[model samples]
Target: MAQDSARQAPAAPAAPARALLASFLPALAVGIGSSVLYLLMSGLAERLQEVLWGPLPDALGIGPYSAVWILVMLTATGVLVGLVVWKAPGHAGPDPATLGLTAVPLPVGTLPGLAIAAMLMLAGGPSLGPENPIIGVNVALAFWLGHRLAPRAPGPLWPLLAEAGTIGALFGTPVAAALVVSEALAGRPMRGALWDNLFAPLTAGAAGAMTTSLIAHPTFDLGLPPLGHPGWADLLAAVVIACAGALLGLTAVYAFPHVHRAFSRLGHPMLALPLGGLVLGGLGVLGGHLTLFKGLSEVKELAHDPGGWTAGQFAGMAVVKLAALLVAASCGFRGGRIFPSVFIGAALGLAAHALVPGVPETLGIAAGVLGMLLAITRQGWVSLFTAAVLVASPTIIALLCVASLPAWLLVTGRPQMQLKEDGTAIR
Candidate 1:
């Protein structure tokens, strides 16, 4: 009887392993598919930008970097995006300010408008990321494909796989998706262990990350001096910088709804978007090209030679970038806020380092990123990972962890950067 029971247990475990492997195959395919779609969309935008900023400027006999060209391109981008939102199929879904990183899947038909708007925003230099719209497209397509191809597949699996895949592709890593999804799923009632639920998503994330790496090789490393050891002064400086960053982000958060409401009051895309673009252009003139786009490359440019910039210049860039983010988010631009917030954090960090001259550059940058990300996203784990990953410094990890406590306290119970329909803030 004991021998028979042992044999039966082994057989039962084999069944689960088989099931897991079966689920994993589909998840992997979904992840790869999602990554491919994301790459295609991003590639299309890059091609559009090359034409708009490269050959078109030459054809027009105007300098591509001139103020006039910048203004014309941005305004035209706004008009094109506005017309799409007003007249395209599905009306480009919902306002991004009211949506989070992940929402219910949009209809497949809505993907075309969203894709066009997102592409225009990317090429036209909006202070936004492709995270939201890309995820929407991935999710809708994944869900539709799953239903059509595998009717017996689990219903909830498609959305989870799509989200994980897109996040992995976006950040160029599976770990980011794991950390984000884990934080999001914490405390929810579940029938199984977290890792059990996570198994399929993780598979998808890995596939997505690998696919993106093979194609784009996206990275956030700043190539700063390595932080060797943590000192008392480093901790203190981190705290101060983090606190300051939190305050800066809070200012934006407080102003978010007002800006959103103001633009929304224009009552139509035709009036609102071009005006927003004009305002953005004027701000661009003030900020120069450094404050444009989603800010990933721009932040690197700012940090490449920190000694070249004055404290005042860093402050000005930070302020301008913040203003641009507010305008883009409020004015119906189709993109995400996280990348812009990350840029703002990097600018604030560099500004702090410039002003004080005592804080190490890497430490200041890491702390500033941590605090600003926490304030903006309210995701502590994601903030920590982003800050630490950018600098790739272990010595400052302890400092960043300590700084996050007070920064969290400041941002906690305050209005978040997101907007809700009820005119109240998300806390």
Candidate 2:
């Protein structure tokens, strides 16, 4: 009887295996879907910009009428917001400051709406971020499919897990996505559901990372040397740099909510959004044409060609860009701030590089990203990873991690903004 009982008993760690598979499969799916959707939406957004702005440049020739571009972007964005509010209610993704690390598992039906609207917003050049839409659509789809496939699966949580997993995979890092998810789910209990969350994101991260590796060797240029070898001076400088970064980040996080609220008070997106475009247009004139839109192209340019703009130019651009982005976002423009944030960081780095001659400009830029991320997201780990990844050097990441500690600490201690209700912010 004892032998029979022993034989019948589970011999292996079924939970672990199951857990692994559970997380992996959903994450992979999320990665695939995210990758495909990201490419599609990004392409669409890019093409839209070309179509919208193609003619104006030729008309201006040498001294392009950049003002028109900004106006057009604002106009387009306003229209997109109008469409979203009218056609796809609740398509606005999470509010970043208020929604750090939180995930509301949206219905599957909502995914299509969210995706389309999100694409429109992004294409229109809003001051939002892409991560929310990407995660939202992924989760929405996962829930729909999961419900259909496993009618007996757990509540809304399962779909959420799958979405989170997909995010993990799409991000090429499970932990960052997990951090984002955890932040999104803040104030909620994770007891008995921890394993489930872990499984999905891990699997998704692996698949996404693998896919990313195959398609594009993603590297984040956070200028730092390899781990275990950061010079003492570098360490000291990093600490100082981190402190500066944290302050900026905190400011950004706190201020952005207020900015959003200001725009929210305008009542209708149609009227308010056009005004935002005008503001953005003015900013474009001040910040230069590159500061318009998502700012991804700008970040790349800053990283590769620092000479493109001088120190004075960079500083001016940063200030202008920040205002433009704030106005654009508040006015109901669609798109993400991730790239713009990075651009802001890069601009800061460039400014810092001019001041601190010896240090690699990349490092300063990276530190800026770290600070901004920390301020924007209370997620220290994600901030660290994001700061490190942009440099695409693991050594730099390690070094930057150590270097940016002081700033993280300072920023972490400051007050943060929280969302109270629809378009409401509570400090």
Candidate 3:
């Protein structure tokens, strides 16, 4: 989904040589610093999850992930997160409903509480992801410390580097970071050649990516049976499933504001978040544990045992997870929609295969992820990257490329899953 070279270039002069060179050192520092922060935040969440789901439950003599435990932990998490957002400095950095993944950095003092809220949601089984808040924290820290350390560097350089680095760490690759940065740069008047502009950010991204790979060995491969080649039918199925997934995601995109407004009417996170958690508890009971959490592991579980659930069950999980994502985002949770959207796509793809054994599983999955991501994020390259990465089959790329066109057509110009300052959903 890289734009053609002609389109990427802008009719503008190159950046001043001195400023560009000054940016590199700080860019490298920002990249590494941001990724380390990402790891610390995510690691803390994982450890907390272990304690919450492991020894505490074992000590209490309750079955792990029992219905009661799910409800209790999630409700407690909501109450705790509510207290932070209610009373903490800067109210945990604004309602997530009003921001996209790319947002102005929060103040430095606000980041600690925001990180805590995000960790709670991650460990507490809300259908959300760490991407947004992690990026926000990283951006804030980078901007604050980076400016002081490299005062002569361009002001915009540090946060952009941190954003690229954090995204690279999140996806375990630099290409995602490159694509996202490129997308952001596409319309603005540019300086220098494309690569000149990209050099520092890409360097930071590579560093961040390598750091995560060496430390966590992160990956997206779902271990699905591979498809050797695709046919006309596969192409058609890809288009159909991509569109279907877009529609599925559209349900949430369309519902976001109404839901946000509903919770906003409740007048406080103390009231709204706990009640949202209760509603999410009901969803957990219906969708089971597979529909909970940030959804990376849950999606892997679904992919591993697609045969374990019936088609109806898969469909139900997809719908319920979508609802869970909507609720979590609309009701004061500090998390992102992408991972849960990934889960919904995987579940919908599995449901497609279950309904029609004729369709290739890989095709169903790539198209599903493509459609769902396109609808949710409204970004083409990352959506394509995510879908193709999960299947880990280069042969599926041609089909995904074609499928994304129709899916993109369906999602273009619609209200995004994110809300505007006036609270209407818009991209």
User: Please, what is the whole-model Cα lDDT of each candidate in the order they appear?
Assistant: 0.86, 0.62, 0.88
lDDT of 3 by residue, 1-427 (tens): 3578868876564446665676677667777777788899999999999999899989999976888988888888889999999988988997898776676877898988899999999988888999999989998888888778768767787778988999888999999999999998997888677888888888889888889898889989999888787889888999999999999999999999999999999999999999899889889988998888989998888888777888899999999999999999999999998899998998898899889888877778788889999999998999999999999998999999999998999999999988887789886
Each prediction's TM-score versus the true structure: 0.94, 0.82, 0.95
Give me the candidate number with maximum lDDT. Answer: 3
**Candidate no. 2 TM-score:** 0.82
In Å, residue 423's CA in model 1 sits off its true spot by: 4.2
Model 3: ten consecutive residues of lowest lDDT: 11-20
- Top of the candidates by TM-score: 3
Clashing pairs in 3: 14-192
Q: Give per-residue lDDT, candidate 2, residue 409.
A: 66
In lDDT terms, how accurate is model 3?
Answer: 0.88
TM-score comparison, 1 vs 3, better candidate: 3
Q: Candidate 2 at residue 372, lDDT?
A: 66
Candidate 2 has an lDDT of 0.62
Compute the lDDT of residue 275 as modeled in candidate 1: 81
A best-first ranking of the candidates according to their TM-score comes to 3, 1, 2
Candidate 1 has its poorest 10 consecutive residues by lDDT at 10-19
